[model samples]
Target: MIFLDGIPISKWGLQIQQEHDHPAVPELRRKAMIIPGMDGEWDFGSESGPKPFNFPLGFIEYDKNEKQRRINEFVAFLLDPYGRPREMKLSFDYEQDKYYRVKIANGFTPRRIHGFAFFDLPLIASKPRKNFMVPSDEIVMESDIPILSDLLWDTGFSDRKITSPQSFEIINNGTVVILFSFQMEGSGDNVSFSANGKTMTFKNFANKSLEITDNYVVKVNGISDLTISNGIFLELLPGTNQITVSGSNLNLTISESLTYQYV
Candidate 1:
């Protein structure tokens, strides 16, 4: 069975196969070659950007009388305009709690079968070529994270603060770079953050709302600061990562959200 964006589309019972009669679903794969020749080709390259997922051909056999309904539903739910595919969360390996984010790459056509009908739809990995870990959307919500100062909090709760580590674990199972978004409002002489084994520091900052992401420029109080040295947008690796934030006379609250993916 296959689920599209958490909805099972194979109520009619579909069979994923290698070929017309191979009776096996071809393995879904992602392929890429080196990076940092900085020039081009033939060197130590990393996993290229998110690649497309080419699903092995699959057959969806439906009752002859219900052919029209099945075709309409599949097309309506999966395809957008101009043959462009829509991103869908497909669930095939339910036991592992993983879903592939994909869209139709080429197109699908139904061929008449023995008194029935069938079609083939291969998918393109929408963003990343990794299978997203489920519940699908997992979040880490931390409240009461101890801080050196409790400047921002409930009224009259400023004096009840401690100087404990602002640490959390990022549970990313994918072998790819996971973009992380970090935003916080605070002030200090020097603000420092340590993730995994990398650290970033900001000096002479006060009363500012700082936002940082792996894909864009760092913004301080609504102003983009491209010259901020030691401003490293940290990417999370596979497994549990140790993250800590510290600074002299710094009191702040940090909110972070990272989407998990796996190959």
Candidate 2:
């Protein structure tokens, strides 16, 4: 079974026959050149290309009269009113927890064969990756926590707060490095975030929320702030990433969504 944008195609009288393309691996986008004096090609690097998935769908309606209507509905769902393909969430029965961001590769037309209407549904994922289908698990760190010195003072709170300079570890179960974002707010003298050997410090800021986007864009609250240095965006490797945040009376929220770029 296949689901598009949380709606099953079977609802529109469409059903996959026997098999479909696995589409687990994406094509590599590698740049290489062979020099006249070199015996092998020079290796630059490679990125991922779009991934394609094809579904051989057959329309089966008990009443022959309803077949055309159902087919039209199916097409309407895949295309917008402007007759253009839209991005959709595509998932399968076997891996319900993951989904692909996809669009129709090309226009589809059903051909009548063996008393059934059949068509090839081609989907192309521009991201060339499958992501977790569920909502992001938000990890929030509040300022009410005891400071690190409290460990000796024996003044830990009843809540989940740990310390003033919060230190934590985030594990990326995926096989590739993935970018993450965080938002922090506090009235303080200085605040610093460290991860993956990179540190970003904001000093003398008050009553403003600082955000670092997954794309490495920094913003004061919702508006983009260009003053932040590049490469301050946080990232998690395949295994564990040690994250340290130091500030006075600050609250931080980190998004824990993980994306698997490869197997």
Q: Which has the greatest TM-score?
A: 2
Instruction: Quote each prediction's TM-score.
Output: 0.61, 0.79
Q: Per-residue lDDT for 50-139 in model 2, tens only?
A: 998889999765566677788878878888889899899998777765678899998778887555898899999988767754323321
RMSD (Cα, Å) of candidate 1? Answer: 9.3
Candidate 2, residue 73: lDDT: 80
Give lDDT: candidate 2, residue 243: 76
Clashing pairs for model 2 are: none
Positional deviation of 127 in candidate 1, in angstroms?
4.1
Which stretches of candidate 1 lie above 4 Å from their native place? 12-43, 49-65, 81-83, 94-96, 126-128, 131-177, 201-231
Instruction: List runs of model 2 lying over 4 Å from the truth.
Output: 62-65, 135-163, 217-219, 226-231, 247-262
Candidate 2, residue 30: Cα displacement in angstroms equals 1.8
The 0-to-1 C-alpha lDDT of every candidate, in the order given, reads 0.56, 0.68
- Give residue 52's error in model 1 in angstroms: 4.9
Lowest lDDT sum, 10 consecutive residues, model 1, at: 149-158
